[model samples]
Target: MKVGFATQDLKRVDAHFGWAKNIAVYEVTPEGHSFVEAFVFAGDLQEDGNEDKLQPKLDAIKDCAILYVAAIGGSGAARVVAQNIHPMKVNQPEEISGLLDKLQDVLKGSPPPWLRKVMGKGQERKFEFEEEV
Candidate 1:
């Protein structure tokens, strides 16, 4: 399975997805993962409003099973989801290594609370837990 990560600098994963300055795309194989190939392109998709600029990067990630991002706007989030690739939000670790370590846990078919709420619609209010004494 291939996995993509959006990082500010190709070197590390900071707290915020920071800026989209670079994207580190990795192709994971059964034997092991390949070296993370860095895509050095401008990350100014928001101001530019040019989705076309991202087409190539998105194409390179077409085969990826998941796209890990530190932060993504609603539109970009929707774009990734439309591609049928699972989007996982990471807390922006200090190191980029060992990122895939949590893949199994992340892919265990449990949606996050916010996602569940969104999917539940009004029913989400019914599932709210009461404060414990």
Candidate 2:
């Protein structure tokens, strides 16, 4: 699954969803993770209630299964959830690589129900039925 990190330095999930200057994306699997791409933003990125700043960021992470951020506004979180993306808020700044590692570890184990749901999004569902003999 794909994961997004809101960062200013691109090395940590240390920025708010609306104020982040860089949004880095990575492909994370139980085996490992790899960097996919990044979205860079410029100009004013303050908490001024400007909803327009969110569209590009949302579009950037549209395919991501989860997003890690230091903080996110209520509206931003709502929008993210509406898009079927899980937004995770960190109490403090965290290393992006470390977060990825933890996610990989969780994938190797039995992820929680919410995580499983997020991971299963866009995947084909299989069902088996028995015919009367």
Instruction: State which candidate has the highest TM-score.
Output: 2
The sequence of per-residue lDDT tens digits that candidate 1 reaches over residues 1-133 is 5667777666565412224666677755433456557766564645546667667667766666666777666766677777766777766454456765444344345757644433332232555788999
Q: Estimated TM-score per prediction?
A: 0.61, 0.94
Q: Stretches of candidate 2 above 4 Å error?
A: 130-133
Residues 28-128, candidate 2, lDDT per residue (tens digit)? 99999999999999989995789999999999999999999999999999999999999999999999999999999999999999999999877887779
Q: Candidate 2 clashing pairs?
A: none
Tell me which residue pairs clash in candidate 1: none
What C-alpha lDDT values do all the predictions have?
Answer: 0.59, 0.95
Model 2: lowest-lDDT 10 consecutive positions: 119-128
Query: Which whole-number lDDT from 0 to 100 does residue 20 have in model 2?
Result: 97
Q: Tell me how candidate 2 scores on lDDT.
A: 0.95
Error of 2 at 85 (Å): 0.4
